[model samples]
Target: MTTEAKICQGPHTGGQGPSSLDELVARVAACGARPRIALAACAEAHALGALLDAMERGIAQPLLVGDMDQTARIAAELGRDISGIAAVHAPDPREAVQCAVDMVRRGEADVLMKGLVNTDVLLRRVLNRATGLPPKGVLSHVAVFELPASGGTTRLAMMTDAAVNIRPNLQRKLEIVHNAVAVARALGIARPRVAMLAATEKVILPAMPATLDAQIVARMAEQGEFGEADVAGPMALDIALSPDAAARKGVDHPVAGCADILVAPDIESGNILYKSLTILARADMASTMAGSSAPLVVTSRGDSERSKFCSIALAGYLALAARS
Candidate 1:
């Protein structure tokens, strides 16, 4: 299990962040405690495979919530058993989501995961103030990617509001950046470099509203609005990721090429970039909704079991960090 040596958060603390599935599994084990996960719609066999793996690794103690028949059926098909696993009977998928959220609110679980349920159904349950787990801040998805580095090492980078917040305004972007900063801190990145991404590195308020938004956010960051992060704005992706390109373009900024967090201009760009990395660049990703009191693992239906497992581990890590 190879762990990426991440720049740890805070002035005195330093440690590594998980760079692979195996490494994340190990990090969760090193916590010496398992996060209780309320897994809604556990009937999905592929998701169950991931839950089973996390349980085997001692990172997750899941309360399987959904149609028991489906769960049992999938478990049997996989030649597995939920003998030690506790389950709640929620025949209706929507009701299953409520059941899972209630479990989290009741302190029976520290994390929530979406399984076979629809995204809207699951998110509605999380947003419902009466029965659902309302978030501490605005809900947004932050995806952490592990790209190949020198000596075959992996570098952990993050992109925010990718799966949520379409066409965010300046205020919404502030929340998004704050959420991403939390993820960076959880990954042990003290003062993570943040790049406010746009088409060009120059700001043209009328023609490019995104650059203006980026400029405002960068100024807010300069004023210590987002604590402990080096924020720079209106940077092209090339300048944000490639040091050589930054040098060639004479973009003299601390976060120009060494950015760990990228604030995309819009959800369209964010989602496209996320899928491109996952599918085209072959980058491994673990994503979840940030700003929730307890971590919420939300993977797409098309995501692989490895992705699900990684998401669970990431949520568990977030849970542990929150507790600390």
Candidate 2:
């Protein structure tokens, strides 16, 4: 049987209203994979909770690396059973990050999960030239969501270099968009509509280079330079997310009304927009590192329990699909 046929054999439980993160994880587990996951700095309470949930549901076999004593204490506080988990003793966050990277590099784990480490510390090891799991290259974060308003079908939005690339130029932006489009394809989105967000709809004179770059990239897509996506950009945030805003501004573009991927011009805008959506709008999120040899889940400590679990589910599904 084909991979899509296998994936479709599962019950249609997603893309409905108020989809559960656990249910997403369960469906991924049903896809004939129980990925071995490596957790770095596994002493944080929330991270431990997510790992515990994944373990209990048989979605992942976690090889946890951190301060063993601290891990035990945190696990006890969370009432998590670590009886069968493999705990590697790395007392510091940097060391734990190295251990996690080495696990994946050695073919012992399929995915990497971050815990209580500093983001830079974890990234330094992962992007280290000599010992990283994947080669040191462009790493971007794309957070996916299954919003109730959109029904059960999953929606993907990406903020380039949000957690990695600080100030990307036009070339880096192309790489970022390509990474996000790969994620869209992995989620079964055919010809995903991409909106390159700008401060305004029009490419104003001498205001921002991003708007000009957006127009250029959209034309690139039209010319078949970029593959498998309809890319339009230099759109305002309001128009990108709201059809009414687009209609009022007389923006006649397919992505303006119904964009599947919203691409921010830079890291600050993307980070601010993502945090605002989560903190203010109560949007659920599942984030992973893209443009790597494997899917990486580095969920924030401030994330909701549901978000953490959903990220694990997303990583699991990507790992399964890679094998498929």
Candidate 3:
């Protein structure tokens, strides 16, 4: 099969993508097969609560890999019953992460989730050369957001590499786009409109490298490098999402105003946008790491239980899509 065909293969309804996180969860539940999620260091209350919620919704089957005593304690504190759930005892946090990663490698789990463990610790094991999960390409983070639109409706949008890929160059940025495109396709977007974000739309060479890279990437997209997606580059933030802003700036492109994905120039800008939306705009969001052998849920420890649950659903949906 072609790369595009592989990326776009999945269960979707009537060629329409989900407009909200709840709809995404519903679709995952409707898939009829629960993806097994291995929660590393599963002793944290919020993470456990989220996993329990996913289990109740029939979106995921949890395999707790942590301190069983602590897990039980957290479950009790949250008034949740984990008696029917399966768990492996690994008191050490790193050991728990390793065990969970091993389960994913062994096909016993379809997703790997971070719990009480630190992000760096969990990632070290996941990116380990010999025992780690083999990446399809370079691993990049994709954050999915459901934002309020002009017509009192909401639309799902995505931003990439906010939590990974510190300073992606032209080549690495291409890989990031590929990873984000795969995610958008898995989420039922038939032809994702991708906006390559930079400080400005004008390319001024060495003065602003991001704009040059964005222009080149956009040209590559025009050459069918990113499959059926519409990629336009060097777009200012305002022009990417606001039709009025695009019109005011006279930016004419298919992805100018109604972009489904925003490709940030670097980690700083991407991370800033991510936190701002979550905290200030109060946007509903879900995030996952793409290019891994299996889906990975690595939401911030400060993220709400709802966010964690949605992240699980997002990852679960991707896992099911890969299987189908």
Clashing pairs in model 3, backbone N/Cα/C closer than 3 A: none
Model 1's lDDT to the true fold? 0.83
In model 2, pairs of residues that clash are: 15-152, 15-153, 16-152
Positional deviation of residue 146's Cα in model 1 after best superposition, in angstroms? 0.9
Query: Superposing every Cα of model 1 onto the true structure, what RMSD results?
Result: 4.3
Q: How much lDDT does each candidate structure score?
A: 0.83, 0.76, 0.88
lDDT, residue 299, model 2? 87
Q: Please give the clash total of every predicted structure, in order.
A: 0, 3, 0
Order of all candidates by lDDT, from best down to worst? 3, 1, 2
lDDT of 1 by residue, 196-221 (tens): 99999889869899999999999999
In TM-score terms, which candidate is top?
Answer: 3
Q: Report the poorest 10 consecutive residues by lDDT, candidate 3.
A: 1-10
Predicted structure with the largest lDDT when compared to the true one: 3
**lDDT (Cα) of model 2:** 0.76
* lDDT per residue as tens, model 3, 21-47: 988888788766788999999999888
> After superposing candidate 1, which stretches have Cα over 4 Å from the reference?
1-16, 19-21, 150-152
- Per-residue lDDT, model 2, residue 199, is 91
Q: What is the per-residue lDDT of model 2 for residues 204-259, given as tens digits with 9 covering 90 to 100?
A: 76878889988888888898765767888788888877788889989888887677
